[model samples]
Target: MGVGGIGIWQLLIILLIVVMLFGTKKLRNLGSDLGGALKGFKNAVKDDDSAKNDSTDENQPSENTDESSSETVDITAEKVAEKAEEE
Candidate 1:
């Protein structure tokens, strides 16, 4: 049993059909674009989490919050998604 009842040969045939339909160049571009989007999403989520954690830390001094945060731009997940879709 290969992949929930489909045989190995069946899988290969499906793959071949897909390759024939899309061609390798288009498939490669699609794969890379998808991968890049996923990577960007992960980074955005990680950065957002880290920002939240830092803000919640009691040990950090609250003095001059505006001055310290001025250098960094806050990126929301929605903005990231829109940019990914554009590309």
Candidate 2:
């Protein structure tokens, strides 16, 4: 089908209805409010980026472990197999 199944005539009709209902003055105020909201959102995003760049210590862990970690291996497969056979 067409995009949103709406023709140019249908869009024009909808626009006419909106203009009649809200009028030019209300539409102007709505446009200004939308512009201000978008500007505020952009400023908020920029502030977030600058805050992330400035505070490097906030991302780092405060404590470091002094103890050494060791790995151990066990070879008890044969014993486990014998126990399974007895069971």
Candidate 3:
């Protein structure tokens, strides 16, 4: 009357055997390591998604390109003026 046809007592006995084979400390360490690995994998997936979004945004044309190009021109002019002043 437990999980599937295996009774609660049978499950408990298997759990006990496993615990006896591997001490409590080892089991705790293994559980934490598995949790850490899952957390790291989640973070990596998030970063990859954000990178893909950024690349797609750059690939598409936007209204800001003209403004950005003008800004670049102004910066170049300023640098040229500074060099002329230095000379």
Each model's lDDT comes to 0.91, 0.85, 0.92
Model 3: residues >4 Å from true position, as ranges?
Answer: 64-87
Residue range with the least summed lDDT across 10 consecutive positions in model 2: 65-74
By TM-score, the candidates rank as 3, 1, 2
TM-score of each: 0.64, 0.61, 0.68
Candidate 3 on 1-87: residue-level lDDT in tens?
888899999999999999999989999999999999999999999999999999999899776566656653578888999999999
What is the model-wide C-alpha lDDT for candidate 1? 0.91
Per-residue lDDT over 2-85 for candidate 1, one digit per residue giving the tens place of the 0 to 100 score? 989999999999999999999999999999999999999999999999989987896777666776566665568779988999
lDDT tens digits by residue: candidate 2, 1-87: 335998888888899999999999999999999999999999999999999887976788558644453334355987888899999
Question: Against the correct fold, how does model 3 do in TM-score?
Answer: 0.68
lDDT of prediction 3: 0.92
TM-score of 2: 0.61
The TM-score of predicted model 1 comes to 0.64
Q: Candidate 2, which segments miss by more than 4 Å at Cα?
A: 57-87
Tell me how far the alpha carbon of residue 52 in candidate 3 is from the true structure, in angstroms, after superposition: 0.7
Candidate 1 displacement at residue 12 in angstroms: 0.2
Colliding residue pairs in candidate 1: none
